[model samples]
Target: MTRYVMVADLRRCVGCQTCTAACKHANATPPGVQWRRVLDMEIGEYPDVRRAFVPVGCMHCADPPCMEVCPSTATRQRDDGIVTIDYDLCIGCAYCAVACPYQARYKVETPRFAYGEAPTESEAQRHEAGRIGVSTKCTFCVDRIDSGVEQGLTPGEDPEATPACVNSCIAKALHFGDLDDPDSNVSQLLAENQHFRMHEELGTGPGFYYLWDRA
Candidate 1:
């Protein structure tokens, strides 16, 4: 079984929103529906303060609460551990939104454009008609992953198969790979780093891991 995960190295993250921009451009998510975002965190006090830029998005948990609460059965987790939303089945009741501890889900009721009323050709091209009035979140670039794999490419290692955010990471803070593979990049990093997952107590088994230490 294949399991995809993302590892974020805090040391290399410079709080640059390049990943966020790349996500927006690639997904063409509506205004205020950020599938991927970097949270600027400041720790300690005054002179001893430390800044950390943590990227946050759909963790694609092993135990997905969103999928559980979806009354319409719109949310489902793929065999590869990618969580996806079926827009046709979704009722946009926001049940998944309320159930999510990560706050990864979004309900876009109205459409908005970059230039107010009229949308540009590029915006229109990227827009998904199926996403409107539906619960939306990150898909871990599943389309790219599937296509890449079919073409004999490794998703987490290949730039074309990886998530846009990971590919756009200027500092190489983000890493995507198969956690199930012992020799995978993500597995090696997790094995060597002092890492933690957000809200693990909730038992989400979030695929996203944060590495605070180099060794």
Candidate 2:
């Protein structure tokens, strides 16, 4: 079976949050909820310390902790190791959210909607609820991937054509591809660079890797 993975170069990430913005726009998340968030942290002594921005989203782990603890089996791993929530099946219990080692799951209030026109309270409420009554988050733009497949380009080859984050990345720090393909950039990046997964001790076996190091 073929599997795909996502990898990122932390060194190249500028923390501009183009990924975050693109995700919000694509997913149409209301103001309070964020499917993709760039977490910033500052550590060490002021003179010698550094600041880092780590973009947080579904890690799509092989041994997903969220899956193990889900009571309703709302969360499941995809064939390619992508983790997703079944909106119709989700009971809004937030058990999966509590179980995720990466804290990736979100249990937010169903937000109101807003169309391109100016927002009234009722219109805003309806428009905001794009997909109501479910655990919500990034699907790694699976819809986009499917769409790209309809076109000529392979999933990872079409940056703008596949994922919103990839399209928004001015630095091209984030990469998406089939990990099984040795020729793919995602695979080559992993082989060539020293990458680290966040919260590795938890044993979630995240598919995503970050390249943050001293060169």
Worst 10 residues of 1 by lDDT: 123-132
Every model's TM-score: 0.97, 0.88
| Model 2: residue 47 alpha-carbon error in angstroms | 1.1
**lDDT (Cα, tens digit) per residue for candidate 1, span 1-215:** 89999999988999889999999888889788899999999999999998889999999999999999889989999999999999999989999999999889888877788889778898877777788889999999888899899999998899989999999999999999999999999999999999999999999899999999866
TM-score of 1: 0.97
| Highest-lDDT candidate | 1
Best by TM-score: 1
Q: Return the lDDT, model 1, position 179.
A: 97
| Candidate 1 C-alpha error for residue 115, in Å | 1.0
Candidate 2 structure quality by residue, lDDT tens digits, 81-119: 777877777888887777777677676665444454466
Candidate 2 wrong stretches, greater than 4 Å: 112-130
Give the clashing residue pairs of candidate 2, or none.
Answer: 112-125, 112-128, 113-124, 113-125, 113-127, 113-128
